[model samples]
Target chain A: MTPETARRKMTGTWSAHSPLTDVPAAVDTELAAFFRARHADYDDIDPVVADAVGALELFVTGGGKRLRPVFAWAGLRAALEGGGGSLTAPTGPGDVLRAVSSLEFIQACALIHDDIIDQSDTRRGRPTTHRRFSALHSERGWTGDPARYGESQAILVGDLSFSWADDMFADSGVDAAALTRARQPWRKMRTEVIAGQMLDIALENSGSEDPGAALKVDVYKTAAYTVERPLHLGAALGDADARTVSLLRKVGREIGVAFQLEDDHLGVFGDPAVTGKESGDDLRSGKRTWLLMCALDRADRSDPAAASRLRTGIGAVETDAEIDELRQIIVDSGAAEQNSARVRELTSDAVDTLRSCHLASPFVDELVALAEQLTERRS
Target chain B: MTPETARRKMTGTWSAHSPLTDVPAAVDTELAAFFRARHADYDDIDPVVADAVGALELFVTGGGKRLRPVFAWAGLRAALEGGGGSLTAPTGPGDVLRAVSSLEFIQACALIHDDIIDQSDTRRGRPTTHRRFSALHSERGWTGDPARYGESQAILVGDLSFSWADDMFADSGVDAAALTRARQPWRKMRTEVIAGQMLDIALENSGSEDPGAALKVDVYKTAAYTVERPLHLGAALGDADARTVSLLRKVGREIGVAFQLEDDHLGVFGDPAVTGKESGDDLRSGKRTWLLMCALDRADRSDPAAASRLRTGIGAVETDAEIDELRQIIVDSGAAEQNSARVRELTSDAVDTLRSCHLASPFVDELVALAEQLTERRS
Candidate 1:
């Protein structure tokens, strides 16, 4: 097993009852149909928008498991049953589905723009939209650089996705009150995430940024929005009260932070094949990740070599040895172990919340187990 | 006045009226304070966003008529006058003021993104965000082309503006129903414009595009969203009934078309200084405008020179003689006069709608005047 996965301290409460195995099948079916329906009107006029719609369909279908949406669904379904959502009928499955898709769309937009913003050529082992369009631009001999055109088009496509998401959610048949409830967290998740993204840009650009600041950015930017809030959003929609909702929020916040810490751990010292990404790319890109920041804070500036490597190793495409050395510094400074504890603490807290959530369904056991696996699984 | 202005037709029974001058001052006071308060949190966070906030403040301060929000406020005040709004209440002004600001924020985001996407170097004679950032990017010696980076950052900045608009709307004092009504049209406007932008790109690239097809694209893309929708949207929130709304839609569509046709005329044949643009810029850029399209449809195959000029003139920096010749070709070909009649007819249709509308307010008169000026004004 890779050392990155081995370091996790997973103590999941999920037993054998979780339905996560069924998630992928459901997500794929809905995605395909949703895409086809959204694109049906493309030919009415503006073939360029049609072209963009085509591009969106192609990109969304390319890769990545629909993990978040499924989790949201599970959380919501569990909430409904616990509250006898049958009798209340506050909202329906359609609204939940629409919300989940909106989240997925949001994820898609983020990834597309992130790819351009980061200038990565490949995503999921395939050419990114920018690269694909850049080649097309060159072949077509369009004005300016194809890469620039690609970036421009990709930016617009992401915006289209974002706007469409709002449209879809607004048009959904979910009980208005329930939809409103779900919307509260959904909106917060987006705002917090965007703010986090801005912070990320700031962290990378500023030389003064270090581990503590990076950690806070990670929580707001990645963890809370990615894992915790999706869970909290689902639970809230299912009518989880203030107390239970509060527990979920705390649980989500803790786990979300821990999850990103794990992601940070993997980024620097991971196997390319297993991770489907190059090891140390993050360090090379000079991301002000929590680990790098921590190492920077702890490093002895008296050693000019270490400081130079840490600062320059990021963003260098060819300095493999320097990247390895930086990884060593991260480990040596004990950031990895500290983050591991953070993960464990968060997982335990989440389990503690579940234990008191008044869950009657067997899915609760699965969620508990899945939460443990998220932090503990050796990938 | 040009023949176009003299021939300006009535659009609907919806007559144009001068906007109440008092509205702009009220809008300015509230918007300035609202923006300042929102950015008041910036002292503790990244100063870049704070600076962006400041730039936005300056931008809105020097904005065009706060027509969209004014309409919204007018509608809300009109709607609530006899219904729910308490004119004597202490918080009434504050509440309505915030609602107007939310509308302003949406417009602000739209304009910012529009400038970046259009890649025009100036806005109201000032250098654009993309240009300012391009200069900054070049000075910083960052990776990638400076202009491209400038565009990228500007898009993100606009996105931040847009997301902030959503949050502001959510928290606005207007009722959820008002927000809901406003939200659908807002989304539609965004979609139509983006689609229109795509159509613009497609037409630019089309080797066989006709003038009629090109004009159709221009109409759908900018005219409807920018002019007509705002007027109707404002009324929708207040006293606009179904027939009134329908009538406004027809007026907006007709006036929108005329406005775009005029813009097309200006792009190809207008004075550089008056337009704050270069002459025949569209021709040099190979833009497929209505005038060129009309010329294409009417070009005499027997006159080899006319056809040749049409081809070579595209993308050519024309000389004064060439400009005169091209202008003659457009005028002599009957394209200008024909399209001018279209503008007149659209205005007539909008004026005609006034008779059909089920509701009437001062906004109808104000909207008509703006439409007439927008469609037929020389500069």
Candidate 2:
């Protein structure tokens, strides 16, 4: 199965040939059951705890691309099918689904905490966890500052999400040895993502404008957890050889970078309705993304005045016209084109690597399809 | 050893007869090594990440009772010594130390987040994590709101602490089966502590006058993670039988409640130099502690005027004189006496349960000593 065939297959309903065809639905089902059981347990403990879990359930089950879990599933399938034999301690599909779905809770923790850090009011066109909790405090006319109340609760909610993710993985019923093996990448992913966040804060705070610094953050903050480690975790769980895991990690890193590059493009150029976020938000917030970094670098060398204007506009411009001017600078400097080209190059490299590795049929094809979808999507 | 002998031994340097004599130092050593390894790894990733880990290392290794790890260690020793013989997969002392030391990171998470929630300036007479980070931002002349920047970084630090804790536990070198058994109570403890925090926030916000509500928070927020579940985790790690675990939990719960009750007394009466907290902070902050609830209830019946004054002063009083007045009201209403009496009764009951359980001699003695220290400490 080539990329073209894989693309065509994805365009239509997934057939039996696609091993991960039911993954998204299956993950949803598992998460729903998990939350339902958690709700009952929390209620047994205290109404307040139950309410916090309810908020988390609403936020988690609300919306997500389920990309991490899908990648993990694909990694497992590739490892198992490519190995030419079942592992001594095999992971059944049910256990795989449960284990992979746990990633979403980790994602939940990331997003919940991210919103508080960014002081973001909305996520996916809905109030973020902190905002929603804040509103609840206000609506109930609770004593003390409502904002503080909201943030504190959201903090606890985020902590609970993390704890739940660990619990779910531990209870996934995978054999102890497999679970032990899986935990290696899982632990690394946890530490890297968190350290990535700290690095981001420090970078932004220091106002460092180096494109290299921005890319370094992308490697840890987005690439590792988003793609590489999830795949490594899956491969480990399947008892894949270290060589195979290493190859998958290489592919995953490339795809993860490409995926984030695409997101950077969307943050600047995509339609708000499609992206569920205002275009040029990265510029407005001065996020120092790779695209912005490239624009600044290129502008500094060739268009000094434009570079000056971009610097002045970022994190200061509020009006649409001002934002539009900054966007024009990014485009006129050829940074936008470069960003898109990099995404394509990275994605192609990732697909080529996956193909050359000779992973089992259909699993390799599915991974190629995923890489294309992630790096090529408009939103 | 009986409580009397246990108390006397605790007053002296621990002897060889004491099984858990070296627990605190052993835990400190393990944690120091863990942090050093983490620092090197974080440095390999990036300087910013390394700095963040450095801050966490300082904060975690700074100061605390190491009570949770000590209790967990005692629990393990009791189970191993009392169970007649080792299970097929016995945990070595080294593995046990590594696993138990991970609790301090969890404690770090709780304290760091608690400071953020409380908007506290200092913890243990040093600037809190958020304050420390905020000061760093200000010193660096960083962009954006310094206070928000501080909080955002602290939130990430708290998250990193939690991830580090889970990672440490996973890499604790414990037998896989033991890790699996330990995770049950570990999972419950994590959830309960976070949920307990939410409950405390909600109860405080709602101005709930019920002593039962305060007790509920104690059961989840402090008691469960701080004592009962740590003991349970140790027992599980030691592969103790179900009946022994149950008995330990029973004893733990009683001691835990007694411990919190004593903390309540100290909150209002202990010296600031000793407790490292301003006396009557619980009253000043309007924490719905059991002591406050009892005082409010007794005052409402005996002296409605005093009750009205207490309500008005709570959370509003700032001066030493004002806090002193509130303290007087509590003592006059007999709440303080009742609180002390409850602590004594609970501690006695816990010791009785421990004696009746017939656990191996010195482990039980160490536990009894620990219970007395915790419940009777000035701090």
| lDDT tens per residue, model 2, B119-235 | 988887789899988998899888778888889888889999998899889888888888888888999899989988998999888878999999988888888989999988888
Sequence-dependent TM-score of model 1: 0.83
Best by TM-score: 2
List CA RMSD, all candidates.
7.6, 4.7
lDDT to native, each model = 0.64, 0.84
For candidate 2, what is the DockQ-based docking class? medium
Record all residue pairs in model 2 with backbone atoms less than 3 Å apart, i.e. clashing.
none
Candidate 1 local lDDT, B1-379, one digit each (tens): 1233223212211111213334556566666666767676543445555655666676677767666665555444333433222233232444544655566665666677667756678888887776776776567665556775666556666666666666665565656565566665676666776677666655554454477678767666756566556655654544445555555566667877787788878877688878767786666667777777777677654455776677667667468777777777767777778878887887888766753444344545655566667777766
Q: Score every model by TM-score.
A: 0.83, 0.94
